[model samples]
Target chain A: MALINLAHGFVEVFQPFNMLMLFIGLVVGMAVSIMPGLGLVMGVVLALPFTYRMAIEPSVILLTAIYFSGTYAGCFSAILYRIPGEPMDVPMLWDGYTMARRGAPAKALGWALVAALIGGLVSSAVMVGLAGPMGDVALKFDSPDYFAAVFFGLTTVVALAGKSMVNSLISLCVGLLVATVGIDSIYGTERFAFGVPILRDGVQLVEVLVGMYGLGEILTRIGQGLHIEQPKETAQKVSTQFPTLRELIDIKVTLFRSTVLGTVLGVVPGAGATITAFIAYGIEKQYGRRRHLLGTGVPEGIVAPQIGATASVAGHMIPLLTLGLPGSGATAVILAAFLLHGVQPGPMLFESPASMLMVYTILASMFASVIGMCLLGFFWIRVVIKVLTIPQGILSAIVVMFCLVGSYANRNSMSDVWMIVIFGVLGYVFEKFKFPISPMVLGAILGPIGETAFMQSMISSNNDWTVFFKGPISGTLMAGSLLALSYPVLQQFLASRRRCAAVA
Target chain B: MTPGAATMPLRRLQAAAPYVVVLAVGIFLYIQADNFEFEQASGRIGPGAWPKIILVMMMATALWGVVSSALRAGHTAPEAVSEAEQDEALTQLPEIYPALVWIAVALTIAYLLLLPILGFFIATIVYTCVLMYLGHYRRPLRVALLSLAIALCFMFMFMRVVYVSLPPGVAPFDQLSYALMAAMGVH
Candidate 1:
């Protein structure tokens, strides 16, 4: 049954319309990725409203293509200019920039592209194999389990907070508060509608996304006087030079290690590409055969994090497809896209043959996107380099225009425009204070689902407070959330103790 | 690197802002959540129950933040305090001509306000041309031509292809949209 569904998806995804959309997404994504200041999450958010008029299949394929290529293209700038186009691309800069400085720019870029291809292929295979069985298991979950799952997903904010857990939690709480501004989901009661008739309709998620990530970003840059020191491109003549047979044999173990590590970490909700990239780099630096020569411009150093970050795309999709839990910020936006299209991507999503086929089609498109990205990056690296030359002030104006049109087009309501402005100002303020915005976005996306699941669990248990801990699955998930929430604090305490002991 | 100079009142105020804002928002939400009516009555979780619970968590978190910030301030040694202040200063955005931020905001507001009145086409063209000029792209012919071309392309894409019913403006400008749409066989 699964085979038949997947085969049907293969045919659907290969259709000319879906193929064209995929190609467009790759080109646009590559363009967006090569530009600094615009991160992968921003790229996804900017493309979201454009998909409003598209069918679900094309929309999913388009987004997947963007997601895939965006990861692939960031390494280009990191190698040629030492400017990481995306945060995940930062790890690539250590060895990639050094390799370029050592007059092997083509070799470093080639290694990154090759690693991305291997990682993406491996991750996709894992996703295709495991997602079906996982979805089947999720089908058996009750309301309490669902609630627990969302709660676990929410705790990702804490895991992602490197230094400021309190600020992240505050950002998350603000998102939850915003999510409650409209009519209450289950009770048909208004909670935060302060007598304004428009407020009763609730805040639109697209407006918030556009306002914060899009317009809000532009406003913040304008405030900074658009004073960014542009990185000078050193590679005058770009070429794609895949590693020779001897060189390929040299980094085989490093490649294999990062691919496996990235694939696994990608499945962990909240441990997105940036973390996976760093972890892969750390592992290579600590344990690889060429560990001493790790940061000194070697293939092993460049390949580790690039492959790990790219391969994790497949890992993120597994949980999103199975339990409808977004594992990363990119997946969070994709989840919002699925819900907007009236498709709830959980266990029930697989019960319908058509929906399952659609899901498979999207997964298949990711594979096609990897090949497309390899070809584009190999032949068009020079053209892609030109995207870096665009001035920030001009880009800001264009972005503002897109945000206005995108927000207005979402529902064609004037009120939505005002909402974007409000959220834009709020987003600008939060950013100035150095607050992480990802938690807030995740909180908004998962807020309604968490509330509904919690309410249903309460109703089913007849107001029994112990329902959450009574079930083994829910109990385990709740425990996981608590551990995740406290993990940072525990790490801090241990580090402090270690320091005291060392001093003594 | 004097301690007195480094630990200026502005730096302390900046450091405390996050905790202060979180506490204020939490208290406000708690007050608002208190007034939410319960149709299902007490004992049963109503519409307000989840929000109330979240608000309580937020308030507690805010309190923790405030206490933590205070403790952190009290524990800092004078020798290392300037070092900490320097790090914070490095992370904070430099105070450039800060009024440019407000000017950009005003420009955006003006563009939106003029959008429905002058239509997306005219409003966007004017907005972009002015923005480019201000941003140091001062070639008149280039700015005007580029803005017009970009604005039309945006209009055609959103209005004609995507079918967004953007305001056509009043009188002559409104007619331009219809004429363009009809010319393109979209109407």
Candidate 2:
């Protein structure tokens, strides 16, 4: 059944319109990601409003193509210009730039491209294998279990934020509070509405996304004087030089290790490509065969993070497709796309032929997108790099315009526009205050699911609070949440103890 | 007191302001959650329960932030901080004309306010041109052409292709919008 569905998906992707969308998505994804300050999440957010008029299949294909290519294209800037196009690309700079300075920019880019292809292809295979069985497992989830899952996602985001845990927690709580602004689902009562008729309808997730990420990012950059340093003259001569078969055989261990690590970490909610890239690079530094020569421009150094980052895209999609939970910011936008099309992407997705076809189409598109990204990166890289010359003022203006129009288009209500601006300011303030934004975004996306599950569990269990702990799954998940919440504090305590011991 | 010592209290207050505001907002919202008319049933939780719980969590975290910030004031040794904590410190951007931020914010709000009044097309072109100019694109002819082209492209894309009903303004501006839409065969 899965094979048949996947065949149909490939067929659907070959349809001219879907292929065009895929092509456009790949180009746009690469372009947006090659520019500094514009990232994968922002690219996905900007593309979302355009998908409003699209079919679910084409829209998902478009966004996933963008997501796939966005992860890989940033390496060009990271390698050549010493500027990371996305945060995930930062890991590339340690070795990619060093290698570029050593007069092998093309070779470094080639390593990245090859690494991305292998990582993306391997993880795509894993995703194809795991997503269906994962959906089947999720089919057994009850209200308490679903609540536990949502609880687990939220805790993981908070725990993994790597910033001040209190600040992350506060950001998450604010997002949860934002989710409660509309009329409650079960009780049919207005929540935090304060008598405004529009408030009763609740805040739309797209508005929050566009506001905080899209407009807020523009505002933050504007605050920094809209200054992005121009790439040096060496960036003009851009091309890719594929590593030889011998070179490929040499780094097989690093490639396998990074791909496996990336896939596993990607499955964890909140551990996105950026985190995966950094951790993979760290592991390579600690354990690579040439660990001593790392950061002095080793091919393994270039391969590890690129592979990890690209591979994790499939890992992130698994949870999104199978469980209706987004493991990262980009996936959350994709989740919004799913909800926008009225296709709930949980276990039931696999039950129906139509939704099943949609899922398979997206998976198939991931393979196509990875190949297409490499093709584009190989031939049209010089052309894509030209976008860097576009003035920051023009880019910022265009972004601001997109934010306003996108928010207004969501509901055709002026209130959403206002909400975007408000949230945009809040986002700028959050950045200024050293708070991480991902937890808040994930919190908002998952809050309603968590709340509904909790409410239903309470009703079914006659308000028995301990029912969550009674079930083995729920109990284990709740205990995980407790551990996640305590991890930072525990780490701090241990660090202080180490300090005291050193002093003694 | 030295100048650094004198400014220290003010800096701490500024740092504490956001948490204080979050605490205040959380308290206010928690109070409003009580206004939900639905009562908790024997088995079912009320609409207010979830939000109240969230608000409580928010307030507690905010309070903790405030207390920690206050407690750490004047005693935070640079050597004692963890590498990760040091890395997490907010890197202050050197503002070239710090007022540009406020000006841009005002311009954004103004543009949105004017969007329905002047229509998306007219308002967007004007807003884009002015913003670009303010952002240091000094050539008038280029800015004008680019802004007009951007607005036209967006207008066609959103209205003609995507079928979004962009703001058509009130009165005279609506007539221009209709004429443009008609010219573009967007009926």
Candidate 3:
């Protein structure tokens, strides 16, 4: 049944319009990922407005393509120049740039490309295999279980976000509070509206998203004086030279280990590509055969991070398709696109043939997107790099315009535009104060789902507080959330103890 | 007191300011949550229940931050140094220009405020040009040409291709927008 659906998905993606969208997505993803300040999440956010008019299949195909390629395209900037297009690519700077400086630029890119290809294909297979069973399991969840799961997602985001757990908690609470604004559905009473008509309708997610990630990012860059150091003129000669078979065979263990690690990490809520890449690189440093020489331009250094980052894309998609939970910032925007199309993801989606087809179509597009990304990366390396030459001022101005226009386009309300400006400032302040944005973003996106589940569970259990603990799955998940919330504090305490011992 | 010692309290207050503000807002909102009218049922939650829970959590967490900041004042522990290092790594950039950021904020708010009054095209072109100039693009003629080109392209893309109903301002600006729309073969 999955095979048939997969085959149908391939056929659907090959349709002229879907294919065009896929191509455009690849190009735009590459362009955005090669430029500094503009990243996978912001690229997806900017593209969300364009997808408003698109069919569900094409829209998703476009976004997944961007997500897939955006992970790989950042290696170009990392390998050729010292700049990391996204935080996910920062690990690439260590060995990818060193190898380039060692006069093996093409070879460094080649290893990255091959690693991305293998990681992407393997993880995509895992995603396809797991999503069905996961959906089946999700079909059995009660309201308490659902609430527990959402709670777990929120706690994981906070635990993984920033140095200070208190700050992440504060940001997340603020987001949940924002979500509570507007007329409440259960009781039909207005909330936090403050007598304003627009507030009664609630704050749109797109407005907050574009404001924080888009306009907020531009504002941060402007605060940094809008300076993007240009890559050297000699660095213009860039191309991917595929690693020899012997070279590939030599790093097979590292490749397999990183790919498996990345895929597993991707499934964990709030562990995005950046964290995966960093963890993979860290693991390789600790355990690789040439651990001592790892940072000094080793293939393991280049391959481990690129593979982990690219492979995590499929890992993220599994939960999103099966459970309607986004594991990363990029997937959060993709979730917004799904909601905008009025199609709720999860087990219910699989129950319908039409929605199932949409699911498989998106899955198949990920495979196609991976292949398309490689082809584009290999052939149009120079064209993608040329985007780095675009003046930061011009690019930032255009991004700001897009944010404003996109907000307006959401409901055709000027009020939404104003909300973006307000949130943009808030986003800047959050950055200035070292508050993590992801927990807040995920909190806003998932708050409503969590609230509905909580309300339903409470009502069904006759307001019994212990109902969540009575169920096995809900109990386990709730336990996990508690652990996640405490992990940061535990780590901080441990570190302080270690320091005190050293001082003694 | 030494200069550093004298400034320590002020620095601590600055560190706690954001949390204090969040706590204040959370308290205000919690008080407001009380007024959300709903009949208390035997076993059911009301509309304000979820918001109150969130606000309380926010206030508690913010209070924790404020207390921590105040307690940690004048104490530069090793753990604190590591935390500072982590924050520095996260920020990535070393230098920051507050004036430039404020100017951009003002420009963005101004653009949104004038968007309906001047229409998408005129307002966007002006916004882009001024932003580019402020961003250190010294060539005015080039900035003008680039801004105009960007505005026209986006106008055509959003209005014609995507069919977004962009604002058409009042009277004269509306006529200009309509004319541009017609020129681009938009109905």
Candidate 4:
């Protein structure tokens, strides 16, 4: 049934409109990922308005294509220049750039491309195979179980929060506060409107997203006073090539390991591509046969991270397609798109043939995008490299304009424009204070879901409060949430114990 | 009485800034949540119930932050050094960048305020051109052309293709949009 649906989806997605959107998404994804500072998340946010006029399947295909391509293209900037275009590209920088500096940039890029292809294909297979069973399990979940799942997603905030967990908690709370400043979802009464007419309508997520990540990033860059000029080498002739067959067989084991590792990590809520890339690279260094040559410049170094990062996109879609839970910030935006189109993704989606076909069609589109990235990547390297010289100041200005227009386009409301500015500043301050912004976004997106599930569970149980721990599935999920929340503390305790043992 | 007493309180207050703000917001939200009314009270959940729960959780986290900060401070001198290094890095940046950022901020505020009045096209053109020039795109003709091109592209994309009702400026500009959009076959 899944195969038939997927095959049917292939036919549907091959239509000119859907394929065009997918191509455009791939190009935009590559461009955005190639450009420094402007991330995959912002790229998707900017595309939201354009998708407003699109059908749900085409819109999702467009964004998902971008998400897939973005993971792969960041390596270009990371290799050619020393700058990693996105956080996920950082791991590639160490090995990819080292090889580039050694005059093997083409080879490094080739490895990145081939690895991304292999990993993406394998992960896509996993997604297609696993989504059904996961959906079946998720369909059994009650309200308490749903609440626990969201709580688990929220706990990812703590795990991803770099250096300061407290700041992450504060940022998340602020987001929750922001989410509360309108009509309650479960109850019809207004919770935090404060009697303002605009407040009653609730703050739009797109405005907040564009404002904080998009506008806020621009402001931060402008404040840093960046002045960039074109590098002379940017005009230098470059040849792009894929690895030979012999070269492909050389690092087969490394590729397999990283792809598997990335796929698994991608399934874990809160562990996104960046973490997967780093872990893949780290695993290769510790275990790969050429460990000594790892840092200096090896294909394994580049391949592991690129493959892991791209493959994780497939991993990310599993939960989103099956359970309706966003596995990363990019997936969260995609989830928002799902809601906008009046489709609540989850097991229910699988019940409908049309919805299932759309889901498979999206998956099918990703396979097309991976091939698209490879084709475009080879031809456009020189042109894409020129974007690096366009000056940070100009880029910042352009991004600001896009943010304003994008926010305004949401509902043609001036209030949304104001919301962007407010959150932009808020995001800037959060950055200055070293708070992780991802958690805040996660909190805002998941706040309604968590609240609705909690309220339902409570009301249904007549406020028993023990319902969350009564059902087997809910109890297990609750346990997982608690374990995730305390994992850092446990890690810290173990580290301290090791230190004491060393001292003794 | 002692100099340490004066400095310690100030330092502690500075360290507790995030906690103080979070706790204050939580308490404020809790108080405000008291007035939330429902037509009929549900058995276990009211309109205010969820908000109150979130507020309590926030307050608890804020308290934890304060306690954790206090507990860690005396043991971690390296954290202070790292913070100092961060401050130094910020201070090392060219002064003009901060100035430019503020200038950009002011310009954006003006743009937003003027947008509804001046309309989308005229306001966007003026805003983009001025912002580009301010950001050191010194070639006047080039800046104007680029700004015009961007504004027209966005206008066509959002207004014509998407059918978004872009804010029409007063009098002539509004008519211009209608004329322009009609010429593009949108009207």
Better candidate number, 1 or 2, judged by lDDT: 2
| Runs in model 4 lying further than 4 Å from the true structure | A227-232, A494-504, B1-12, B39-42, B70-96, B172-176
Task: Note each model's CA RMSD in angstroms.
Answer: 3.1, 2.3, 2.0, 3.3
lDDT of 2 by residue, A100-127 (tens): 9999999999999999999999998888
Better of 1 and 3 by lDDT: 3
Give the proportion of true interface contacts each model preserves, from 0 to 1: 0.50, 0.64, 0.74, 0.58
The positional error of residue A286 in candidate 2, measured at the CA in angstroms, is 1.6
lDDT of 2 by residue, B88-168 (tens): 221234445657777888998999889989998899989999999777877899999999988988889888888888998
Chain A alone, TM-score for each of the models?
A: 0.96, 0.97, 0.98, 0.95
Better of 2 and 4 by TM-score: 2
Ranking by DockQ: 3, 2, 1, 4
TM-score of 2: 0.96
lDDT of 2 at B23: 96
| DockQ measured for candidate 3 | 0.64
Per-structure clash totals for the candidates: 0, 0, 0, 0
DockQ of each: 0.47, 0.57, 0.64, 0.46
Candidate 1 vs candidate 3: which has greater TM-score?
3
Q: Which ten residues in a row have the lowest lDDT in candidate 4 chain A?
A: A226-235
TM-score of chain B of each: 0.75, 0.82, 0.87, 0.73
The local lDDT score (0 to 100) that residue B166 gets in candidate 2 is 92
State the lDDT of candidate 3 residue by residue for A157-205, as single tens digits.
8988877889989989978878888988788788888899988998888
Error of 3 at A89 (Å): 1.3
